[model samples]
Target: MAKLLFQRVADEARPPAILGRPGCGPPDYFTEVLLDDLVKSGAWLDLELKRPFLALWVNDEDFDFPDWNDPLIAIDQANVRKFAAMDPVVDLESLRGMRVYHDEPYFR
Candidate 1:
């Protein structure tokens, strides 16, 4: 399902704002679920190392994602600038506007 969605974005060039936090499907299973699809579909996926956030884009214009306003979420200086250059209007002052899930550690 996620692969098909991303493939559609790649095919049509309409990138949506993809956001998530700790436990939800996105930031949680990003590496596990989305990376392969993004790569296979030939779309761009910018993974944030510090914080669990990522952006998807096929073209420079349709790029979209949230900015935590906190440096912890930014990958690096150059990467930050690259995202800024892609779409200069995606300014997210806080993650309050996005759908986030609190993750609880599972102990066995």
Candidate 2:
């Protein structure tokens, strides 16, 4: 029963819409799911660590900021420089397990 429900949820779930600027590649469905789970589990804060730098999503409702580290631009950038300089495919796959931060401070 639990397995059936999990499958159902997975099937019904749609990837989060990527808005604003164009992204470098296809939508990261796995990252979206992990982000959702982190939000639900209360393990995520507003700040996310993409790699070497820290960043906060500008407007999660409309768009997700490119993941990055302090002194780093994008997660892809850090990954490329540090890990997958020669293999893009491998770098993309590695992104799935990266830490995603949420619950950023909101200003009115």
Candidate 3:
């Protein structure tokens, strides 16, 4: 299911993130249940670190989680320029090639 969702964003490239936010559903569902399942199940799977996913757990005092979101950014100056060069008005289609999985509210 996750792979399919990512493939929808970029057929050949990897996206930066896979956001899990509650939308009209129980807040606990996104804030707790999913992470619990992942932690228990993550050990069963094997994944490489390169081109890896930087999972972010949104921290809110009201909704606590067993895990925390670790900062996953590790880029040089040149990559910053490459990202900055993007023009939202003209380069909307270029995101796929960039492999940036944004965690902000869903938008395309």
In model 1, the runs with Cα more than 4 Å from the true position are 1-5, 14-81, 94-97, 100-108
For candidate 1, the per-residue lDDT at 66 reads 35
In model 2, where do residues sit more than 4 Å from their true spots? 1-27, 44-108
Per-residue lDDT for 93 in model 2? Answer: 42
The lDDT, on a scale of 0 to 1, for candidate 1 is 0.33
**TM-score, every prediction:** 0.24, 0.22, 0.23
What's model 1's TM-score? Answer: 0.24
lDDT of each: 0.33, 0.30, 0.27
> lDDT: which candidate is best?
1
RMSD from true fold, candidate 3: 13.9
Over 1-108, each residue of candidate 3 has an lDDT whose tens digit, in order, gives 244322222222232222344352454333233223233332121122112221222112211322234321222122222322332112222222334343422322
The 10 consecutive residues of candidate 3 with the worst lDDT sum are: 45-54
lDDT of 3 at 35: 28
Error of 3 at 24 (Å): 13
> Across residues 78-98, which tens digit of lDDT does each residue of candidate 1 receive?
343444334322333332234
**Residue-level lDDT for 85 in candidate 3:** 33
lDDT of 3 at 73: 20
